[model samples]
Target: METLMAVVIGVLFACAIYMMLRRSIVKLVIGLIILSNAANLLIFTVAGMTRGAPPLIPEGLYAPSGIVADPLPQALILTAIVISFGVLAFSVVLIHRAYEVVGTDDLDQMKDTDT
Candidate 1:
């Protein structure tokens, strides 16, 4: 299970980077989203694949093996999602304005527009 999750996240990261290199601004934005998701998964995986367990220690308590999954990763992901959303929203607006003013979605063409 852990290995599978790692592979999945790795694939997402690879795809994200590949898309980020595209000539289209839209693809770049999409890549950013994928990258953020991959990062979240990474944190979750590194935190251990096991569900939450008792944190308290008692005299030979022999606490239960599993209780619930940790909520920290989920919370962290929420923050990441919100941050990514704001960035994506801003990028969309910027891209729209760029397309309107420059008449092209290509980053190369955008670069040449200033001259």
Candidate 2:
């Protein structure tokens, strides 16, 4: 499973980079979204794959006993998700506004207008 996830993450990262290299503003935003998702998956995969109960310590115990899933990765993934969402939203709004002002989504055209 971990190996599979690694492969998937690699593919996602490659795709994201390809999209980001495109000359379209919209594709750039899409690439950003994909990059964020790939990062999240990488974090998850590096944290190890385990199937067990939630990390809940019994009364009077300092740590969870026996086989228990790690909470840190889950927390990290959740935080990343929220942050990515915010970035995506902001990027989309910025792109829309840029499109309206520049009247084009092509990066080359947008660059020409800077003068």
Candidate 3:
């Protein structure tokens, strides 16, 4: 499973990079989204997949009694998801405004809009 996930993550990263290299502004945004998802998957894959109890202590115990899921990686992934969503939303809005003003979505064409 881990090996499969690693391969999938590698493919996603490659696709994201390829999309990012395109000349279209829309493709750049798609690449950013793909890159963010790949990052989240990488974090998840590195954190180890285990079916365990929650990271909580029993009533009288100071620590977990058995194997417990690590909360740190989950927290990090959640935060990253929220942050990435906000960034992607902002990017989409920015791109829309740019399109409206510049009348084109091609980066090469946009270069001339400033003049």
Ranking by lDDT: 3, 2, 1
C-alpha lDDT (0 to 100) for residue 83 of candidate 3: 99
Q: Which candidate achieves the best TM-score against the true structure?
A: 3
Model 2 / residue 69 / CA error / Å: 0.8
Better of 2 and 3 by lDDT: 3
Q: Once superposed on the true structure, which residue ranges of model 3 sit more than 4 Å away at CA?
A: none
| Model 1: lDDT to the true structure | 0.87
Which residue pairs overlap in candidate 3's backbone? none
TM-score of each candidate structure, all chains considered together? 0.81, 0.95, 0.96
**What's the residue-level lDDT of 101 in candidate 3?**
91
Evaluated against the true structure, the overall lDDT of model 2 is 0.94
The C-alpha RMSD in Å for every predicted model, in order, reads 3.8, 1.2, 0.9
lDDT, candidate 3, 57-113, per-residue tens = 889888898899999999999999999999999999999999999999999999977
Q: Model 2 reaches what TM-score against the true structure?
A: 0.95
Worst 10 residues of 2 by lDDT: 106-115
Candidate 1, residue 22: the lDDT equals 100
lDDT digits (tens) for residues 1-115 of candidate 2: 9889989999999999999999999999999999999999999889998898988889999988999998899999999999999999998999999999999999999999963
